[model samples]
Target: MIYLQLFWEFFKTGLFAVGGGMATLPFLQAIGESTGWYTYTDLMNMLAVSESTPGPIGINMATYVGFTAAGIPGAVVATIGEVTPSIIVILIVAAVLHSFRNNPYVDHAFYGLRPASTGLIGAACAAVVLEVLTSIQLVAQEGGILKTAALTLDAAAPLGGVLNLRGVALAAVLLVLTNWVPKVKGLHPIVFIGLSAVVGVVFGFAGV
Candidate 1:
């Protein structure tokens, strides 16, 4: 029953979230609110992890949310649900190629979709930025430096309840290395992801 629910929810999300992964953020937020499976904070973390990992951000987020909610079976169901709509749509459109090929209505529909997609994607980006920058003002106000610092760290790891400065430093260093080093310019993102994971593990073991 839980698996079925997961599938239905994600199917709806994928069906309507037409733009891209970022575009899916709003729908995912709607799902989060409707299902109570997670919170806005959880959504932010999912976005971060999804972007940092392999595969499309939307699919990755769906899998993450599903797994977090109901484990392995949930992940499978959610993934299939997210992709099923695309498969069905493509098949249907292929079968109706002539009806759509030279239709001005179809062309106009697509022309309209361009901006709608952009708006959805832009909204998603803004939401994520809000989550990350939620504490900026605290940090900006000199009197609340500690509070600001705490909020900033909470944005990264909600469970730790404390800032993991080592992890933050690791991320900062990687960002610099990836941007400034010519040799690292073309490296696959997975390499950096693996390195970040290793760094996180090491820091965790060291009690940092």
Candidate 2:
């Protein structure tokens, strides 16, 4: 039963999350909340691991969540479910795409999906930012998302104070390096991810 449920949930996610891997973040977040198999923090961690690993982020996330919920079998089921929609859609599209390549309706349909994808990705980014750089919801737990706003770096205060100052600082440095730095900007992204992972391991994330 758990396996079936996992498959159904991820199947729906794969069917609707059309933008790409990043766009699936919102669906995965809701899945985590509704299923109760994992928490928001767990989802964030999964996102981090998924981003760092090989293969598509969406599939990796599905497998990870499934494994957490059940085990190896759950992972297989969830992964298959996640890819089924894509396979079906791709096959159908391939069959008719040549015939309808210039159809106005089809063009409009694809165009309509753009905004939905953009909105999903944007929301995902906002959620990630909040989860990573702020301690608002982490401290709240079951209290509420905005229960309190800690505005200090007093680690001894409560819930690591308002924000993850170190995380924010690291993000700033990375942004500058990846976007503004002369030679650094050209380096592959894996280098940054690896560095960030090392930094996280060495420093660790405490309250925030």
RMSD values for the candidates in order, in angstroms, are: 9.1, 6.8
Where model 1 places Cα greater than 4 Å from the true spot, the runs are 98-208
Leading candidate by TM-score: 2
Tens-digit lDDT string for candidate 2 (1-208): 8988888998998999987887788888888888899999998999889977888888899889889889899989989988899999999989897799999998999799999889988977876897778754423344466645443344553345676788888999999999999999999999998899888888774533
lDDT of each: 0.77, 0.83
lDDT of 1 by residue, 1-208 (tens): 8998999988988798876777778888888898899999999998889987878888899899899889999899999998899899988988787677899987898899999999988966765654542322234354553533333444445435353456456757887878988889578987897887787787672455
Clashing pairs in 2: none
CA lDDT for candidate 2: 0.83
Positional deviation of 157 in candidate 2, in angstroms? Answer: 8.5
